[model samples]
Target: MSFRLTTRGLTIAAIFLTVVVVGIGVALAATSTPQFCGTCKSHVPYIDEYKKSAHRDVNCEQCHSKPGPFFFLTAKLEALQQPIAQITGDYEKPILGYVLNQSCRRCHNNDLLFHPVSKNGIRVQHRHLIEAGFLCMRCHSTQAHGDAVPPGSRTYPSMDQCLICHNNQFKDPQGQVATSRCDLCHTKPNYGAVPLTHKQNDWATRHGAVGILSTCSACHVKKGACSDCHKGILMPHPAAWISEHGVIVGKRGGNKACDQCHDTKEYCKTCHQVKMPHPAGFVDSHPAVTAQKGSDTCFNCHVVANCQACHDLHAAGDPRAHKLLGGANSSLQSTPTPISSPIAGGG
Candidate 1:
């Protein structure tokens, strides 16, 4: 018995849809909460410190009084305030030395923090943060207190903090304060900012030289003035380095800039002394002669020293008389081994 009634079908569908909508609404209501206080995101310091704050009288509504919630709401209010300010020209200028006075006045303002010394008043007049119109939150508080952080609520400069702003470099060995964050000068302090000059020096063609761009900058005291910044051995070409390199018994550079990174003799000997490419039988036949090949690391299998032997550290270009791994003492030469097949074992 099929009775086709169009109005009844439409009514039934609407009722089912209404039930589904109400069910979804109830589920959403159960899970959500109303943000009445707006304190969920940034409330800090256990509510007690805030109550003790000098601005404790200032309501959350006066500053945070705008409609809606969160940063987006604040931003919209700020945009609207800007236009109103333009029309009215009313900028909310903070009080001068405001934060210090407010925080100090919270407990001791007139005579209590200091002995009310008139001479101290002369010294206190030099307060830069006060002149900067910074609020207490700007340089000192839980949210804003790294040494590098700009002045805020969580920040309180120590005694060394004064010297950090001074022209002279202050070192507090006690580790109480690290004033490295303060700019010595406007010049950038990062090591990576310096350019690498050594790469241009012909070594790039041979062994594929590479170095960190900032390594040189770390030693540089000031930007661009290499001589003024680094003195003595720190200089690119120290007189001491030349004196040491010239007299050393072993061949240097061989067009290899080993000295750039390595500061000592042991670095070269460790590898070269072990696996020098001399004839395989030479090690067993003449251990003393093969082992005694100083800086044998450069000597390749040809029985003669390679370019590393005679290679000039000063000027890397080829000269007519230049030979690889300069002439070794053949005066104590080893006898050559007879050619033997791999199948014919040597005793």
Candidate 2:
């Protein structure tokens, strides 16, 4: 029970233990390099992307690893499992697993964390979002590189970050939205190419249905900006529009607003399948108009069958059928004239 190793034996044991400790230290140091991360085929792309990123000069571990020994070891151990998962085809793509807000705050910590100020008295503060448990990635996903980063391309910011608060659909507790005007954000406006979202093939026709009107108000002040090209159309139509817009459309000779936001053939035909250009009670006035204009006016929209069915005409090639305008009281006809009802197709 009193057995003990000699001093020489103890010294030999100490040297062997020291060699093992040194080997572990060297292994950890070697694997910590960015080059080591580039060794994996899946990680090579991310490493190349990071090399061209804003944080290119910064150490990968600084943002990627936790501070204290326990957490750091946990992170490293988790990282060690990634290669096995990658080989097994179980790894997530785009490399978005890490949440680096704590690492970002380590360097950006200041009074601005609590009280942020904007030059134009606009609310640029983000403390409320932080307090409500939002991560930095929510708004800053592509700060260093775009989500779909191309090789050698400069890091680009997403416009969604600005639109999140500046959009008209978004409002503060006071029910006021930030100004979405172009001059408010840009010194020199680029109005040539519109927003990328607006570049769709059908944008011109479908914008009114899907677009944010406030976004349009950002660049277009809604005065002549709209009517300059639209010429005779009135948009966001005036009050009592249902009762009054017929006159506006008539004065313009056509509905320019309709042509602006719609493909007349597809959109107009779908709704006006039962009717043409005339409104209700038009049947009463069509007699004089058609008589002055001749049968060609009715033939513009109606087929011969429509007139025949209305007039209950037995003869097919009778040009004198034009005399029967506005339902002349002719009981001599076999079938009675059917009344014309307004078409149920107006939106």
Candidate 3:
């Protein structure tokens, strides 16, 4: 038979239960601290950066854990693997973590959303973003960690991030469009502030080489902003532009305009397969040159009328034209191989 519980036994049991509860509470509190997180060598760099960040005064859990007891407990339970992973050296490189919008709103508050907040000349309308269901971490991901991680891992907001939603095409629930006007977001934006890349002497000529046209498009939002300076030539020209550029060049009255972006002297000669402008006395030597290159190459710059102008004289039985026609025919007969059209080949 089971023995009856005595007063002494009951008192001792109650004290033991209380002690266990208090011990668990203490352990949970201790582990939630940034100090406890920093104990893992992998977290030391993040902790160091967090200490220097604007949110240094805020506890790690205040942002990392969502508000309410259930989420707090859940975050704590999820954190249990950190120590195990650290011991086994099995943690992921560039450790990833997500901060909930609820966690941010706990301190930031809904009041901040009603009005735009200015930071570093940027006017951010939180209400529009929050209503649109954007996460606080979408822009402020690096606020606590700073640049502790690699560039790809750092989620600090940039013009590109803003352009994702502020591209004028994106509309709110109320049908109000998100315009990409710099004035809407930038308070007294120094539009004249030349980028560091633009400050270089050769930037005017070499800007296309950087391959960051999206960065350029962020500010140059006009429809033909690039084409304006490019003289209607599409910036970062299309694949077909290589084959079709000859037609464009011909319409523009020679490759003189191409000198704006290209070193036409060398660049043109590479594809032209001959002197681009045709050196002095080219008219005299053109018969041999045309026969060697082909009539198609001539069509790149000259129409059939150009050849007809000289050939018509031969029809009239001019002595000089007869001599020139004989030379042209002889050269044409000698070159049996046919050359393809430079216009078609984009030569």
Candidate 4:
């Protein structure tokens, strides 16, 4: 009886092994066929094009399969995967800007698509997308939907994105930007937006000759060489002052730069004024503070008042102390014209 049982068991094991081999062969045949109906996309449409892609030879079953018993369960799973197979037909590589299936870097590239770099010759270190837990789908598209879409379908994010972390990048420690004088570096630029901000008819847009934009540091640098224009703190003409200091800030002489050395009435005195004390009346100040330690033009302490100190040009109905600095640049020193510039905050 024992011998008979052993022979019977050996025969059963041989038949089972043969059945397993045949099942494996059948699965391979099914996966290889271009006309298979039941398995993951065996045809691999656009096979020639995929052969040239970076994701060449990545099989469809690898992306849509799970291991299980081969008979009824596998058949049911394949039924669930049919629509997925049909929907992903002839598609290009979907997952862009990330690791390859072999787990290698995809975006470690030599060709720069939009590599961020400093305005100077500095290389901007990019953030690691994988380490940050952001997939390539964060900035790029996939091909699982249909045919591959053009890369340009997405728009570049604006500067507002940088404000997320560098919230205070454009503001001071107090959270307020210093000033935004548009005409500071721009002699005349974009005058369109001014009307939007103010209730005036504005010629505010100073769009330059094609791709020229303004930066924060462009006009705010302390151009302190205005010593020749006046013997004191520099003051610009109110008509030409820019309140926003952006690239659209206009200049006075039809250029995109501020007059670092001159005022509106006179030329850039720093470059044009060869004589000390000026030729005659380039900048006439009042109260004759010339005898004092430091006082030249009306900017002695009157920059806060604009051109109001030198001439009351307007006759408003008030006890206006708005008068010129001196009495025609004659008698260089006397009782001191006793006139002060206008007030700033209701002084």
* Best candidate (score: lDDT): 3
Q: In model 1, state the lDDT of residue 230.
A: 23
Ordered list by TM-score, greatest first: 3, 2, 4, 1
The TM-score of predicted model 2 comes to 0.46
Q: After superposition, how far is residue 65 of candidate 4 from its true place, in Å?
A: 5.7
* Residue 61 shift from truth in candidate 3, angstroms: 1.6
Higher-scoring candidate on lDDT, 2 or 4: 2
Q: Give the alpha carbon lDDT tens digit for every residue of 1-347 in model 4.
A: 34555888999999999999999778655663323532335334334444455545454343333332453346445545655756877434442222232122223442432354442222232342233344333333332222333354432322212222222235534565423443321344454432222243341322211212233122334555332333332333233322333222232233224433224223322111233334566455333333332223334223424545434545365434433334423232323221222322210
lDDT (C-alpha) at residue 76 in model 2: 76
The list of candidate 1 runs beyond 4 A from truth reads 1-46, 61-123, 130-138, 142-153, 167-347
Top-scoring candidate (TM-score) = 3
For candidate 3, the lDDT comes to: 0.73
Cα lDDT tens digits for candidate 2, 1-347: 68588998899999999999999778666777788877777777667767787778766666777666676667778778877887798866644545567766766564676575553333445664565466776655554444444333323333435655565556666666666655555544454447776888887756655566545655565678766766656555555664575577678777554566555545443324433457688767766665555544344345555766855554456656566544433233233122222322233
* lDDT of each candidate versus the true structure: 0.38, 0.59, 0.73, 0.37
Error of 4 at 280 (Å): 70
lDDT score of residue 20 within candidate 4: 100
lDDT of 3 by residue, 65-138 (tens): 88988888888998887789899999778777788898889888888876988888778888977876888878
Sliding window of 10 residues with minimal summed lDDT for model 3 = 333-342
